[model samples]
Target: MLLCWRDVLLPEGEHVTEKVVRSSTMMRVVIVEDEGITRKWIKKKIEDLGMGFVVEGVFSNGSQALEYMNSHDTDVVFTDIQMPVMDGLELLEQIQAMEKQPYKVILSAYDEFCYARRAMKLGAQEFVLKPEITEESLRSILEEARKFQDQRNTLDQERLKSEGESWEASMRQLIRRAGDPDDIELIRQLEEQGIFLSFPDMILVDIFFDGVIRKKLALELLNLFLEQEQTKGTAFSCSEQEFVIFYAYEDHENSLKQVQKLRKVLKSHMGVEVYLGVSRRKQDCGWGKMYRQASMACENRRFFSIPGCQSYESMRITAEGNPSEFCFFQNIKQIGVFLGQRQYTEAQIAVERLLEAVGEAVYLYPAYVKTMCNEFLVLYLHEIWKYDLTEEEKGGTGAVELLFEQAASHFHLLKEDVLKAVSYMTQLLKRKSGINGCSAPVQEIIKYIEEHYAERISLAQISDSIYLSQSYASTLFKKETGKKFSSYLQEVRLEKSCEMLLDSRISIQEIAVRTGFFDAAHFSRVFKEWYGLSPAEYRKRIILQKGNRIIQ
Candidate 1:
């Protein structure tokens, strides 16, 4: 009655083990035996054991079984030794080398005790003789394997959970670092990372949320505005109470227009009242300037201002101004203080009053007003150019007159620049208007020319791409952009040729071809006209300048 394994086996004369049993909870198992009849018999016996065990697969040879085991998730493997190719011993060795080896039971007909001992040494879970293949023996081995699988599964889940927690913690740390402090050093670091930060005339908007979760929502809304498709060169920061946004653009009026669009989006989406103040751009502008502007814009929002935004320009300058008598310096300082303190409403009121006074002055003293406005605009633009300078010339000269000259020429070539500026200002004042007024089609024409300047692209090709008649496109383009299409294209090509001349490594002929010129001789003629020097002379001058730097 002791139920010994050997006593349960059928006589040696029988080819198959005749044990009929079944289990409800099937434990996954793999049988790797070369003999088909023996493998089938063993599988049937395993299924007969009502202890809930299921055979997942049966491989005819040890090699095939090893390949299946390498890719599969099996609880137990029953393999026979002494096979023709890749014996169970070899398969056991391979399994032991795996990172997570399966529980293994060796099934053999040979009464080789030595083989059993070897299997045990190779980490085999159990060794069973073919004649002693009884349900009791099978049950013992499966129970042990299932226990091992459960432990491993628990460990795997714990490991995955830990990794998830660690990743989340790292993200939280990064967010904290970004929020720790707002200062010049931080802004400079961001700039070094290729985030543009320069605003000569900035309107700072401090958006505060009333509800507990509203602040977070407002911050998200502000960030979305900065990343809007139509808005470019925008930066922002979020703190507990406020979110500050800075807008930098080539044209101040255009920037304000974009901000107005953002204001409308926020009002429609969030249903929260947001205050804004505009600050004049400082000579030394960075995070400090941004903070100052936002503070001022917020302060200016208090004086019966609309729910959205206001600009410093709207506050100080009037269409009817005797420009000479306007106190530009005093108004600038007052607006600066309003922004610095986040007094947006006060700033708006002050700016509006100042603008009215300036408007009166403009009519009384038109010439003086023109001079003052030009001087202020130029000074503001020059400060911005300093931020755009290359790293090597951080502290180098920033000449306003030179930038003004460039702007004048640029405006002459692109007559729509002033119109675009005007349209942008109008859009800003009218919040509901979207940014569809700019001559985007003309801009597309300019962009295409710049990109294909190295190729021999023609006006006909560009006109077709922009969907305009060639003659009409040429005439309209010239009228809107000030320069003839052909002239602009030529200027772009010549500018590229001049840059190539500085390289010295490129031959004149190669430069000519690269810059879309027909031949080197023709290229030389255009180069001389543009720069008053041949390609070789330009190269010589660049080399001399480099040599002087090295000597110094």
Candidate 2:
């Protein structure tokens, strides 16, 4: 209708026309029509309605309108379909390809109405008959265009805001250096960039995520936790699967309970465990120490047996005295010997012991475990590569790289990788040799020696098990393994007795009986002859060398 309902209140000639009647769109318009009179009439009707909408340019055909509009910015286009040179439909289609297109309206007569459908498909926002072009009709279309523009503008602003926030979060992560948070210049830069803590005393929470998350989904989950009215803190992603949060230290107990609730919620919904480490409330800017403390707290979760948040005060460092990690190393070395002897069962048993050490040595740093696993693999590959392995057995550096990556992610993966690597070596050795370790006869002979090394064993006893003549069996064993039967038996007995000597529980006489020696005198003589020391002397010297007495 009209601008304001002041028609009844004001005199007849007095009007609130142009100022109040129009929409607030202020949308610029371009008109193209073959009929000059109709183009003038439409322009006049829009002007009569109000100045809130401006007709930027008017043309007799679509081609002229297209050229003028190309160099200018226009918000809307009104065109007639039956124009000369270029039709309204063509102009509408051309405008569709522009980077910033205007709202489109079509002016059509009854006969030309068939093309209106095609024009609308070409991106016309409204279509009106020439005879029906009224101020009300014009205002209706302008208001619709205005509403659409408002919505688009709002979305654009929101997108910009989201991007800027993401960029700021990324910058915060880069600015805060681990173990070096006190750099004056860096701190000043961070503060200048508005990355400082909001309170002097704040609790830092370090978070570690699993891996990837859908950005929108992650944001939705994150907003639920951060935007809670009871929680006053800021959280930002440090990297994929990792984030950090800072809470104004209000109450120590409250902070812990608050973040713990966040962790539980995230874990329950995200289907992944989340760790929240709370640092001892310190001066807010002293985040270097706080960051380290907070990180150390969460690291407690590295042991799968331990779950939930840990605070800075609860962090403990493993001491260096009497580490059972030594026992782990000793067991690791035994694996190679078992594999060489074709004792896959014993080799795997040794592997299980190493993994047990990994699980129990929670006091030890992860790097220590990672190093032990790496050394074990490196030593294994070095030992096996010395043999003329088949092409398949030489697994190359793929396993090496894989183990390294597994160590970085989680120590549990190291167990799996070690098994696979060892299995590959087992396959390699199996292929290089025969079924188990070597020829079937040789394998049986070695098995018999190790099983009964503490008993009175003879070559004839081994031959009977593998169904070979004693002389032939001895020769086959020597040929395949490069050690004579008697020599192999003596080596096994000496190795066993030496290990027992380290334990003071076994007596000299008992050692002889346990190792299948004929007597104490014979055992001492043979042990001295082979090892360059008598049993008692060897035990004393080893204890001295280790700087500790051998205990039961």
Candidate 3:
């Protein structure tokens, strides 16, 4: 009954011919031969196959085999073509129709090759003629079937992995806009594509950046940080300068340790200042709200001059929720009006009132306090521009970053900067108006100077226009306007130059020519003499200042 498979050897160095099957994988088998002797022999052969094959049943007809398989599972079904009741083909169909189809092998005589081919087309794994059936042939067939199943399992695993990745991506999106019905619907659709997510109570950690970092690099670092803490967390980019991490609420102590690890890694490895705002654990549709709380907490950390974690719950008690009680917006608007009117004293008084109101409203949220300060500074800058102040008098708006930092330690520094702007504008206004009450001829001279200051002019030219001698015209112009002819014209041209510097992005060289300077270097020299800053410096200072001055 056995054929020698001399070339085959098992992993244990046993001869493949010594056993009908050599694999460790136990394959349940059934026999459906109509001949009693052949069915008995097949069953005995499977039994002799040793470890891998188990002869589950021996049937005289395909009907009995199918009936046996109805309740019991078989890994491989071997059926003879000729049967009394249901033929092997019908039995193969019924077996293949089962929820889990077994590996089918058809047993046929040499003359039943056509039947074997038909059975193979019906999802049978192999066909073995009765005369050629051998230990080697049956074992090879079973080995081939095992390989196929292994490959299928691998493919299934790969598919599962791909689905897991898709699920994670969808979860990130869902968490970002959590509580939104549309996003929740999107999550359901994503589940159809692969895996499903049920959100547990979670905490949001918002990381704010003080400097620039590439998004890809930041994400990688964040992942590494999570790995170091052995924490399972999800991170997504929030903005150009911020990122957010969401971790399931496991334990408060462990979560705090994760935050500390992240902060340390960001500082030691990335050389960056990071502030983390942690929100309390929230479940269901509160992810978006939790994000806002964490963001507010993180932003407020800047007020302490320290880089560390801030918890939203810690600050909730102090936030008054009524920002209007302080009248910050009203006093800020009044101060702007007074500055526009060149009422330095009145603007100072309004500023004092605003500060006093702020002091009294110490119960306000830290976010509101920072926002009020920024609005006040922006409004003051806008008003300074209205008074025709030079860029040097504006103290360069880039300094606002420093001022904000200082306000954390010394709030008075901001007040001093604002008052300095007020005084600078007032002094500039008084000097510009020294010729306000000049005589009619002097007024006429001033008017001509204003209209034609861009062009070449001299005291002689002015006196000729007025029908007076040059020497007498000079004395009269000085006595009435309190400025010599050349000094007055220089003042008018410099003032025009300052206006162009603040309001326009035109080239400095073109500005010099338009402002009646012979060349850029000469114009810069005169500008530096008057404003204590070169033309380039003045433009940079004002541009920086204006950029930071957002309307409240």
lDDT of 1 by residue, 20-41 (tens): 3333234678888876667778
lDDT of 2 by residue, 1-552 (tens): 011122211111122232323333467888887665687788888878874787767777777788667545688888988776799888888998775678888888864656877987998888888888888888899888777777876875687577764554544544354234465654554566454544565667777655455545554666577667344455666556667766555566676787778778777777766766667654433665576566655664543334567775653322346523242545656766776576765676687777876666554444445656666666556556665543323444343534532323345545655665676555444434442558767766766665688889899987887788998987788887778888878987887687678778889999999999999999999999998999999999977855531110
Question: In model 3, how large is the Cα lDDT of residue 206?
Answer: 89
For residues 457-537, could you state the per-residue lDDT of candidate 3 as single tens digits? 888888888898999888998887767889989987998788678655678898889878898998999999999999889
Candidate 3 residues lying further than 4 Å off, grouped into runs, are 1-165, 180-202, 208-242, 248-261, 281-285, 292-324, 327-448, 459-481, 495-512, 518-552
Candidate scoring better on TM-score of 1 and 2: 2
Order of quality (lDDT):
2, 3, 1
Order of quality (TM-score): 3, 2, 1
Q: How far off is residue 365 in model 2, in Å? A: 5.0
* Model 3 residue 230 distance off true place after TM-score fit, in angstroms: 8.2
Measured by TM-score, how close is model 2 to the native structure?
Answer: 0.38
CA error at residue 334 for candidate 3, angstroms: 7.3
Candidate 2's C-alpha runs over 4 A off are 1-201, 208-233, 239-241, 248-258, 268-272, 277-344, 356-367, 385-392, 395-408, 426-552
Model 3, total clashes: 1
